[model samples]
Target: MALLPSTRAITSSAQALDLIPIVNSITSLLQALNPRNPNPKNLSSSPLNRFSPFLDPNLVTIVITKQTNPFHALFFFNWASNPNPNPKNYTHSLRCYEAITNLLLHHSLFYPAINLLKKSQKLSDFFIGKIIKAYGDEGNIKAAIFWFNQAKAIEKDKYLYSFNSILGVLVKANTIDLLRTLFDNVVKEGGFQPDVSSYTILIRGLCKKGMIESAQKVFDEMPCKPNSFTFNTLINGFCKKGDMESARGKVDEAKTVMSEMWLNGVKANAATHLNILKGLCIAGRSAEAIEYFRWMASCNMDLDAKSYIVVVNEYCKLRKIDEAVSLLNGMCGRGISLNVISFNSLFRTLVELNELHRAILLLLQMPQIGCSPNYVSYCTVVCSLCRTEGRMREAGYLVDDMLRNGIGLDATMYGCLLEGYSEAGNEEMAMQVFKEMIGKSYVIGLESFSVFVKMLCSKGMIVKAENFFEDICRTFPAVERDGYRKILDEHQQITQGSIKEHQGEESS
Candidate 1:
């Protein structure tokens, strides 16, 4: 449990420099180190002997944390644990144990975790909560409760860890009522003190269950100040419940907290602004959301991609394609990496407005923007091109592009293509598409079938249409057959009326 001596950090440097890259390099070496060393205590026999000069607690912890293979992590942990290159012998710190133990438990390496904890004299009640939470994370509430009870019998005053872990377990299980009962009992007993985490878990449960008022009450009653996470939770809960007035109130409170944090020289979590943007969007005040987003962009708050996408989606929903594109271009100018969601928003809006030309251009330009067009991007424009007259050729090109890109078509895309072809009087292409659909067992829906039959009859292909119907209509579901019969019957009536008009013209 003693601090491992840093790499002759015993000595000083002339100027301050970043050693993180060097530490990362050493960690990579340890991660790639073989676990089956014949001499586990000696680093000179292995490739890591070179890094012994750089070995420190920080590097050791990083090495253990980075290894996905627990046995490999254990090997490095063992090799680092040995007293080497130092007259003042030191061992792995408690923080190293936490890092390794967490990694082991994350991978369900329980037996090894227990062994490490016991060997390091860390197998105590304080560490038991981690085990409890691990079970809860895997959705095993019963096992979590068992551990909680085990901790319960050991120490009365130090049961707070077990209590907080159980609260989180109950929250995950959606057992809000039982969690509240336990919370109430704990408070009444007053055997232990509950920390910010305890209150946050209870508030999270209440918020999830739509008990916002109760969550707020707990927030107001909390002895400790709420963290950003606590405020974000309450704000999100109100937003989910469509109580933006309350959400905005919390957002204002969060702003004040952020201001105080700023004055205190604490960097505010950039997500604070993101929560406000989402709340504004949920309240249908997208204009305000856009304004807020622009303000965040201008500031040094350092918001992430999601903040831009949220505003981009809002702009799309408002049919403000120009503003959305402008925001995206601005993001590109700032060297912010964009995902397909940013481009897809534009594609979808353009398609909705019958702007296939613009949509197609955007789809092609996606790769140029350093982002690949996803299925939604191609499907949106391709489906729109199919809807417009004389655009099926372009749709086919896009479909070929999709095939080249290895994107498979879903039934929705197929049906949309069929509808688009039928509506454009491209019956030959429609029929070929139908043949493929039939081969794939993709049944044509009522709307697309009606469009197909109408296109056939309107083009004077009556006999071919009749034969196609008599054969295919029977194969359709009985309900769809009935609907098709009515459609055929109405078209027949219209055709007979047209024949009578032709005869009257001859008589005249």
Candidate 2:
């Protein structure tokens, strides 16, 4: 018998199996397995069970005949590929692995499915390249580099494709040193010419890292002159670095080059406009940021989440709380969803303005907008509440709420609550919170202990304050010890001045 059957015979056999009908029938059968079936007994007696033999191991040959739907074919291929003691079936495992990888790559489920195969210790440089590409999609260059190294170590033969994938990842990650080392290796050992894509990735990464000078040098040295993307990346880099003069010059250069080349119809994209706006914001030119925002609106360019965030932060930084709030509300009115960074910025501004009520309301509104309060949001609100007069109870409630929602309370949050109780003249409650912090093995910082000691001394608990001060002095660094000593000196000065004032009054 031939090692492989002819295509005609395989096609005739597949048609005889009527794969489409079989898939439909299987799908229906799986659907009927639900728990809400009205007549359970009828399902129990259905004819689907008679076809249960179709799922049997001995029926592998028959299952292969019915391979059609990619998912269903994968299911059968997996069944055929199971490790069997029989030596004759070893080739089936290779076919099954190839089939599964192809199906997953086609559907873009490359990373997860490749991970599943890796557990079986069966992957080659080809499979590793696919995995690296998937990691690149997720912007996870570290994981891509790790897998690339693994592939190189195991593959006996040096594959240039593997080097290219890793180099691209490193460039995307802005790992300039790694990129240079790999580039040298590629040239020395892999003997592959660097492509335009490779050079572009490095230039873009350098630009993103604010190494504009190096990026420009790379651009100048490119054997194949630069393209528009290369220019755009450089311009965006300069804008990000707040070198607007250079950014604008690059833009003008691009236009000049395009005109000279007679390459019309190519212009800046949304990112180009957004970068300019961001640069203006970072340079504290809020008026310019707003002007560019309006320009973007007039040009009908879709404003992104970051565009709104930049304007909101700029307004907040200038202490224009009302304007920031108005912008946030306007963004919602325009259906521009706020992400975590935007919400955190707004929350911090509210905290700084001592608008605890509004900050609390914002925290409550996060989940409604499909945003959850992260650690930063929780910490901001907690710190604000701690600073509020007569709001120790509310601060306590928020801490408990954070814990209940599985947001692990950190040492700083615990310290804030302790300080809140102490400031509110509830020393006992403060002690309780301190005990909780100690139980969690959190190293209490010097500033925190200093606050506690001052609170204790104010309440005429000098001995306890001295003991706590001693503990802090022992644990803290030299710089922190000096800070604690300053607090202690201030406390002593206040005490002595009070005694002198009392004596003078008595003598009078």
Candidate 3:
């Protein structure tokens, strides 16, 4: 943040403090005044008498705003509320009242602030708004609303402060249900008219709740002109709007809102509609998003990788994998690249749906679209194929692809390779992968190691199985070597007993 001039100081000249020297003089007098008699009865003895000539609303504002101490501010405020001897009959303006009220609230002196505000008959909507927000800071929603309703019942002001304060608190508290109720009541009352702020706050709350259509509805029927803040809020709502159940009318409705905003002198930019496309995607309305993007293109708006990626992610979630594949191919054609993360989502989805071939094609074509395959991009396909019965060869080919792409196999991938080859009954390939896994100091998991050991023992390669187990125990100290060795010894003993029994039967 920029270093700014003091809030209490005048900006007119180079003066960094209150321009009136008497403000400081009065402040000093106030701080040093009698604690026994807050208002000193002896005027001649009081230094404030010398500075009393300078007491005015403006001077009082300067002094109070500068005070870091709320009590000092209150003292100055009381003195300015009515100066003794009554030369000027100085009165507190709404600004003076605001300064002192804010100062008291800033100090967390809530009770005193309320007392001063009520005693001075200065508890208007603005002051009430501060108190409401103070209660909101305490998470005391009931108190905040009580003050709001109390102010509303007594005062006839349309909502300048209290509404914004209470509504903002409600929005933060996720109490939009109640906020909507109050808004409807205020509008239905007919006597008090809500201003731009009231509409803005409610629309923001609605947007946050993903009630896009409702927020849009509010935007459409706003009685007053929407300001930049309101327009910005509406556009943001369009980005996250969840109610995309509108078959096709939402885009046109958005266009109408934009056109109206343009007519109202809030110029609509073409780039802003990109957010609406995101909204369309978030609602899983892919068809509408495509239409919206096409409309954006017709407006000659330049869309980027992020623009296509948003739709791509949403499309991946749909059952129509073919459309997602088509969109990805089109993105490649446009020279727009997807990151491996995006392709990974597609890969996992396709592989899960038993579309391994399609996933492999996308993986191979990732480079054509300028995305280098990551560990996850290859692992998703390779791991799925390893689990399939007849797809072990395809898994091997993907491992080669992974190596060629400079992506090394971690323990998970290595374990998958070992388990796949072993379960397929390929002794030579299983040995090769085990060697590579060991060379990388990556220990195969106990499950896959068991598969490898059982495969070797079944093929009468018991010595090789024992050597592999020892190698694994050497590298991975956490392996249950003693228990596994006992199992291996039992296998050997069982094989010997069967052979001896068979020989004895032949002799008989």
Residue-wise C-alpha lDDT for candidate 3, range 1-508, written one tens digit per residue: 1122354554433233344556656656656663332243553334455445455667778888887667667766776566675576667888998888888777677788888888888778888989999888878899999999878876775445887899899988889999999889877888677888889999999988878789978987989878867876777666554445652445455555666677789865545566667766766667878777777657766567676666667777775677766766776777666656678778888987999998899889878768888999999999999888989989999889889878888989888888888889999999998998888988676677777877887787888988987887888788777776776676667666767898999999
Which clashing pairs does model 3 show? Answer: none
List TM-score per model, in order: 0.72, 0.60, 0.48
Measured by TM-score, the strongest candidate is 1
Better of 2 and 3 by lDDT: 3
**Candidate 2 residue-wise lDDT at 188:** 66
Ranking by TM-score: 1, 2, 3
Report lDDT (Cα) of residue 443, candidate 3: 66
Question: All models: lDDT?
Answer: 0.76, 0.66, 0.76
> Model 1: per-residue lDDT, tens digit, 1-508?
1233365564443133245555566556655554553235544425545556555677678777777677677777766777355433646788888888898889887677877777777765667788888989999888888888877776656788888989999999999999999899888888887888899899989989988788978987888777767766665665553566766555555455456546645455666667768877877777888888878877867777888899999999999999988888877887889879888888888888988888887787877877888888888888778777889888988898888888988777888788888888888888887777766766677677777777777777777667766656555545467776787767767777888898999999
Worst 10 residues of 2 by lDDT: 1-10
lDDT of the structure predicted as candidate 2:
0.66
